[model samples]
Target chain A: MSKIKVENLTKVFGKQKKRALQLLKEGQTKKDILEKTGCTVGVNQANFTVEEGEIFVIMGLSGSGKSTLVRMLNRLIDPTSGSVFIDSEDISKVNDDQLRQIRRKTISMVFQRFALFPHRTVLENTAYGLEVQGIPKNKREDRAMETLQMVGLKGYEHQLPSQLSGGMQQRVGLARALTNDPDILLMDEAFSALDPLIRKDMQDELIELQSAMQKTIVFITHDLDEALRIGDRIALMKDGVIVQIGTPEEILTDPANEYVERFVEDVDWSKVLQAENVMKRAEMITLDKDGPRVALNRMRETGLSSLFAVDRRNRLQGVLSADAAKQAIDEGKPLADLIERDIVKVRPDTLLNDIMVQMAETNHPVAVVSDDDRVRGVIVRGSVIGALTGKEVKTHD
Target chain B: MTESIPKLPLADVVEVIVSWLQANVGWLFDFISNLIEPTVAFFTAVLMFLPTLVTIVLIAALTWWLSSWRIALFTLIGLMLIANLGYWEESAQTTALVLTATVISIIIGVPIGILCGKNDTARNIITPILDFMQTMPAFVYLVPAVIFFSLGTVPGVIASVVFSMPPTIRLTNLGIRQVPEDLIEASDAFGSTSSQKLFKIQLPLAKTTIMAGINQTIMLALSMVVIASMIGARGLGEAVLTAVQRIEVGTGFEAGLAIVIIAIVLDRLTQNLGQGNGQHPRN
Candidate 1:
């Protein structure tokens, strides 16, 4: 369900005419000439897939190629080398008319400047995109009215853009983009120009709209918090490369490299990562309610050996040691009685780093999982260590 | 005498210029006469199509509708007096000639203003030429115009348009550029083509300033009647010029009053239009 795929994208601006002339006289290869007077790559061989109905964010600082990358997706600025596919159809080879057709039908872009026509009334500005696609005036106006209402700008349609405040003007811009019913909406810092209070309001509005519409959105923002808040998955970009792309929790706790780690390190992890992310899946373990003798035998028999003691309700109790179980059997006690239920556990959704810190401070080998006093799984010290050192370890059930 | 020289006060310099102008007042009378001659002839020529009485009433009614009723009432009174004062027909013709010339000047002026407003190259080319036209005296504008198009209402119109057209062009350019950048960008992002951007954003936003420019142009054109009449153009300017030559102060005052009335009516109409809706400053 990849909605758009961009591959081997590159953008180079301006040829060195003087250098070319000098090189021609010296009979140097074009490669040598290019090497000597190199073109600045705005986007260097970028590759990514935008999934269907997902909010994909491209995050970067100024001049980090994220803006250029987004622009290339819609062919706002053509790439020097590469292809962009919308639903697996190559759009780069399309003629101008076809390109505009694609833009009119499939993609709509909202600019940082909120580019609404000033002379036209707000209604006219909203109806403009439909008008461009040759929708008749009365019908187009009806469409515009619907869109204006959708963006919460219904009554002031006759007023010029100059008559409204900046935030209201941006709302008009949003209405203009949505009027066409484009499949993929590309917002290039669309809210960055507004005041912080208005920016937050617009963000909430976008999220609310997204919930109902579920249109595939490719949002570009420099603010990490905005990316984390709005993005289903964020691609952290730096110096023309995607350093990492992941869910907010993965990016925060297990950043792919130093650049991404620095960006995520300062984030309030407890608030950003949800319970669903850190929750251990229940399929990893089997229930065993038999006494200490059978539990110890099961632990010794299993390879990469460990035993998770659980009750009939499938709630995690604690890990039972083979030696402790043997002594428990010698004392003639039940397995649940011998099993340590005082075990500290993290919820599945807790941040991996937060769990590591908790385990370090408690000096425990394992932490039990619980859902309303019912144990789910044990987060062992080995799992925490493996996550930290980028090691993949088999989960103990 | 050289060693003990004293400087004159600033008030003395102002007095010098004022006294010099007053002393040469007779020359001013002759200059006004030379400007009104052709305006009278043009009025006489257009009179065959419509009677003087009908023209006067129509013009008075137009003034009333376009401007305030008070100005219209005053204009009607002035026309009735001009008709009775033996200089009525001549004054009517002069009025027709001046109005025609002013309309034509506006027709040509606004588009040039729009062009300069929209393009840097056009502005750069036209700006210096307008500078010379504005800086040069009224009589200076008449020289080449008369040489090329003979002495008549046409040459008078040409000279008047030259002298009055610069403010319109310059103001229109200023107004267009003064439109907020965000509005212009908004137009662009909405996929408005270049032509749509201009008519929709640039022109509408610049409307007040453009109207203000046109207002100034009209005022300048009205001021040109006396000067244009000197080059054989007719109107109230001719009556004023002839009266002054005969030392008929009452006659001159009557014609001058008529000119002032017409100017007031036209000025108020343009001023009202410029200051109407869409002028609310961005809060």
Candidate 2:
């Protein structure tokens, strides 16, 4: 089962909820429904499932219901209709006590404004969730200390939140959520309030933390770039409805609608598109099986100066240049002797921006390798430049 | 003959209501008075029992602890002046009365303020009542105080509480309402119960504002001392009243000066306490 499954979740903020829901069922726009019923649609028919340990991002412009949708996941904002199933239990149907248990034991949240209690010490703020759980003081503090240390706030425990800088205060907020050790983290615009540099640092920190902790995070943001950088799957919200849900590559390459297209149009493609998206199938030869003559023929046919030489298992051995191939064929040497091992190799997930750098520093195309060192594909310098310039590059299985 | 304009009988309406309350709910007033009497008496007796020199020294030390030495020195010199002028005992009695009234007002005001703060309907209902309590003349409360508790320190304490309580209520409500929405959400997001949120997050963050409210309450109670004296409550107010009745300029000046000195000391101490620092200046 998915870690969280939300189906037809909706929220209407005002008294005329019945009318609003009717209009919603009739497929009225948010503005038309508001004009007709005087009830604002906060979220409309939001349906998605968050996989375990996935960083699922909900992104939108302000008032697009992204924040409202996340709040519904934890039942902080009750849904007007439909349900959210966490671990196969519909949280919308849970009682107050059960909801609180869900919040305490299953889900914890980091807020946009770094909502640390100003009167509380850093340690006390970090321990707030554990304290709410009725844990003993010493035990809670010990756990809070460890969480604080994990967030890189070791020696600053006794200081009040007001005494700390904005970034440090946000770390305390993060530590507060982490101390609960919950399965799902609902971060509502968690880094939007920080300085640009600090925001980037915090995003990096969250990514690093997620890799280590493997917590399912449903992060909310209005920033497409942030979503692209950190999200495993992104749900793009617009006008109280989720317009699209896809991976960053899919969102960038094939938007679900015009709104999604325009939303992603301004994103730097070099950063968003990885080697997997830009790579083309390159003609290659197995070093153990293919002779230099075969390598030369393949290179000539592909109209390339070199070909990647791999083992029978497709593990990359090295590159075979046209000169080396011809020299090997004349000297009757093995293809292994002619192979050059100095070429750059990248993983499929390595960003095109980094691949561009590699392309700039080398004359040969970079080889895309799998974790097992098998050659997946090759990214030519032309492909990197073409992808950045918005030309479609052929991708293969 | 020109048509005469009809007069509105607001005063008669109030008089009838007061009479009805006096007749029907007199026992309730007696019960409240019974509760308040001992508290006022105990505080009064303690303040009067402490030797004037000891009281002065202790107050000066407390002021020094809570605020700057300048204010402390000011308090020391001010208390000595009152003692030299032979009004120290009366000043102490007035201080006791203000303390009693402030404590009672806080007891009545804070929870009501919290209710108003938490619920919009409660706030809408209580706001007009608070306006009435605040805007009504101080002397108007005395008429009901006398009818309920009769002429003495108890009636004076009751009147002072009624007059001074509004600021505490209004400000406490404002303070709690002013607690940032995000912080309240954070508390809720952490699964805090309603009472836990109030105590742990709301109250602590609202401390400065609530303390400001208490400071206003005490100051308002102090302002009521002389007015309360007309209903037979004793203190520096009595001395001032006596001076006024006898037309003694020297006595009135001394008593007035003593009241001013007490007001300054109370104001500085409470203001400093409201700032949430009793030890030293904030960096």
Candidate 3:
């Protein structure tokens, strides 16, 4: 089910909203509209749908209107024109009472500045959503306590938000949002205020939490790396308009425009390009059929240091190094006898950053295998270096 | 040289308006006086009915409860000094008058402040009116107040309210408006109604500032006591007024000293009301 669907949603701040909307519809740029109508386009003609249990990231630079766009999702700022549908109800058209009811039951937001009530203790801040809903005190606190513990804030329940570090404060913010158990969670720069190391931990924690809870999330951020790390799909925005939306691999490998291309140019490829993206088609000898002679001949022809050994089903068995294969042929041994069964293997989805660690742990090449144990690709040290230095990694057959 | 603007007849215009209000709303004014007089009188009577030593101990105990023992000690010493100076009744009356004005100011001011804080248009409309109220000379309010309530503590109270209310209203508005924008947004995003947001979020965060405003109102009301005495209001102001007429320096100084002691005690009491609520995060 589509938990949220925004259609032609627009917000123009200031008095001349109608004029600004008209100018925007006529294709005037945000700056041009601001000059002509004295109105700034906050979010210009946004349209997207969030499916159930997906983390949809809205990534952009400052003033790109991503923050404004996420605020529109929960009707925090009323749309000057357009519709926001949450769980198929047109929230933009809902009356104040109806909108509030939807906000209470269907959506909650986490803020950039860790907007935990400074006066409220951690437990009180976490329980605020339920408190607004008028849930009984004992019941709400019980639920809030569970969420606080879930966010790793078990012992700090009575401490105020200002007493915590920025990262800890945001955990309370996230716990506050989750206590309502809303289907859609809107996180507006929730991790942007934290330092880089803490932000990475938070991003990892959010991804971990999302898998267990399966809430549809609309995450807004200026950090492309953070977006790519947690987002199931990313919508790149510019100047109040969404330029493109795609998966992490699609965005990194196939940018839709020069703006997106430049925006993603500085992203660390080792984090984004996965094993499948950076790997080459693996060459292996069939352990049940191929002899040591075949493995040695193939290694010599390809100028490769090692070859993978696989069963007849093409399932990975082990690896055969040039030294082992040559020693096997000299000693008149079978291919299986020379196959090193203890070589490290990774799934095709493993990140290059992880593969780099695995590569450093051993002398053997990393084999990318499928879930069912078929050898899909291989990551050589040369290939890993090429991928780290190159902007685009070309997967060779 | 003759004035080019024809002198504006502003004084005559104001007098005519006051006369018209007195004619039409004479009963309304009487009703308001009836309401205010009894409340002020009841509190004054209770304070007067108590033995001087008993009242001082009671007030000192109250200060001890509301604030630290240090302020309680100061209040105890100050009240005893006022009693020792033979101005006990006058001190009691002034305390009663100031407390009544402070209560009325808060009751009438906080709602108007909330309105101005939440609505920009309301704020713009009220801001200039507040400026006029504050900038007008303090004694000028006596004319219409005497016309409406006809002289006594009622008119005195009416004038003091007009004088002291602006600070309460202005500070309340500022406190509410100064609450962090992100907190307001957080409340809104959580489905809080305007009232819910006001009570649960804005007001709590603004409590310290609003308390400061109330403290200002009390101090201003106390300052207005001597000025309010020009009408028939009784208190230390009347004692001071009587001394001025007789040229008795010792008597005037004693009454004046009593007022100063009372002001300090009230100031300390109200000033301590905002403390130790866990308002700020512990370091």
Candidate 4:
């Protein structure tokens, strides 16, 4: 089972819930339903399942019900209809005691506002979750201190939340949620309130933390760029509904609808889309096994200018141009003999925008290699611009 | 206008409730009176037992500890000046009365404030009663207080409690309500029990507002006790009443000045209790 499965989950705000829901079922828009029944539909049939140990981001502009959707997972706002299954247990149907246990032992939420208690010192606020569990003060403080240190707030434990900067206060908020040692972490736009540079740093830190902790995190954000930066998979929301759910690359390259398209349109593509996202499958002639005849034949048949030369293990060695292949064929030499070591190489995770500069001086396909020297894919200069501008590019002749 | 509304029996209804309470719940009133009368008297007795200089010096020291040296110096000079005017003992009795009434009000008020803060229905029910308690004339409470507890310091203490408690309740409720909604959500999101949320979050956050209210309560109690002297209560109020009754302007001026001195000291001390928390205010 998935870590979290929200099935046809919905929430309505106001006294006329039943009428509003009926209006919703009759296919009325959120505005239409609100106008008719005076009840706002906060979440409308939002459905998705998050796998274990993935950052599943729910993203939309304000009032899109992304916040409401996350709240219903923990029953912070009771669902007007449907079920939220965490580990195959229906959390939406749990008793108060059961829900409390789940909240304490299973899921912990970090909020957008940092929500650090102004009256409490960093240590006390961090230890609050454990304190509520009736743990002894010394033990809880020790645990709290450890989490605080993990969040890079070791020495400031005694200071109040108000004394800390916005970033430091959010670190305290993170430490508070982490002090409980929960399995599933819910981050409701946890970094959105920080300054841009600080937000990027926080996003990087969260990504690093996630790799080590491997907790399933449901992150919420209004910024599509933020969603693409850290999310393994994103659920794009619009008007109280999930418009699409896909990986960052898929969402950007092929949005599900006009709403998702608009959300991804102005996104800083350089910051999110990697080399692997835009790279084509690399065509290579085996370095030792294939000779100049084979290289020439393959290049001619594929109508390509050049091809990567790799070993039997598929480790990239060098490139062979069509001219160089002809040179080798005339000289009666092997593929390895004519291999050009001047070919540009990039890591698979390198940003596509970075590859454009790398592609400038080389006629050969830019090789995307792994850290282990494996050939992953190839990118052409024209394709880089094509990916950046969201269009198809003609191969460089 | 003559007979359209038939002259709603509001006054008579209130009179019947008071008489019924006096007739049927007289023993409960006596029990409360017995409980409260000696507490106020004991505080006064403690004040009277100390030498004038010792009490003044102790108060000055307390004021210094609670606030700044400037306020303490003022307190020192003011009490000395009052003593020089021959109202030291009466001022001590008045201070004791204000302290006793404030303690009772805080004890009764804070929990009700928390209840009102958490429960909408409780707040809705109690808000109108608070309005009635606050806006009703101060003299109106004295009549019921005298009818319930009869005369002397008991009725005076009870009347002062009625007159002085609304600010504490109102401010505490407002303070709790004013805590950022996200903070409350943060608490609830952590699965805190209601009591944990109150003690760990609400009360600490509400402390300054509550302290301000308590300061207001002390001032109201001080003023009400002076008014309470008409019902046979003791202290500087009695002295002032006596002076005013005989039209002794000089004596009345001295007593009134002493009351003002005490009010300043009490106000300064309580106000600093809230301000000294050293927390930078946050949203």
Give TM-scores for every candidate, taking all chains together and pairing residue i with residue i. 0.67, 0.95, 0.96, 0.94
Per model, how much of the real contact set is kept?
Answer: 0.36, 0.70, 0.84, 0.68
Which regions of candidate 4 are displaced past 4 Å?
A281-306, A312-314, A321-338, A347-349, A360-364, A370-376, A393-397, B1-15, B278-283
**Winner by TM-score:** 3
lDDT of each: 0.73, 0.90, 0.89, 0.88
Worst 10 residues of 1 chain B by lDDT: B274-283
Taking the tens digit of each residue's C-alpha lDDT, what string does model 3 give over B214-277? 9999999989998898897889988888899899999999999899988888888877776644
What is residue B126's positional error in candidate 3, in angstroms?
1.9
DockQ for every prediction shown: 0.23, 0.63, 0.74, 0.64
Q: Write the per-residue lDDT of candidate 2 for residues A3-118, one digit (tens) a residue.
A: 99999999999999998999899999999988888899999998999999999999999989899999998877889998999999999999999988888889999999998888
**Per-residue alpha-carbon lDDT of candidate 4 for residues B94-200, written as tens digits (9 for 90 to 100):** 88889989999999999899889988999999999999998999988888888888888888989999999999999999888988899888888888888888988
Runs in model 2 deviating more than 4 A are A288-290, A311-313, A329-335, A394-397, B1-24, B278-283
**lDDT minimum window of 10 residues, candidate 3 chain B:** B274-283
Candidate 1 per-residue lDDT over residues B154-190, each given as its tens digit: 6677787788888878888899889886566445444
**Deviation in Å, model 4, residue A98 alpha carbon:** 2.1
Candidate 1: docking tier: incorrect
TM-score per candidate for chain A alone: 0.69, 0.94, 0.95, 0.90
Tens-digit per-residue lDDT, A204-284, candidate 4? 999998999999999999988788889999998889988899888788777888878887778777676678777888889
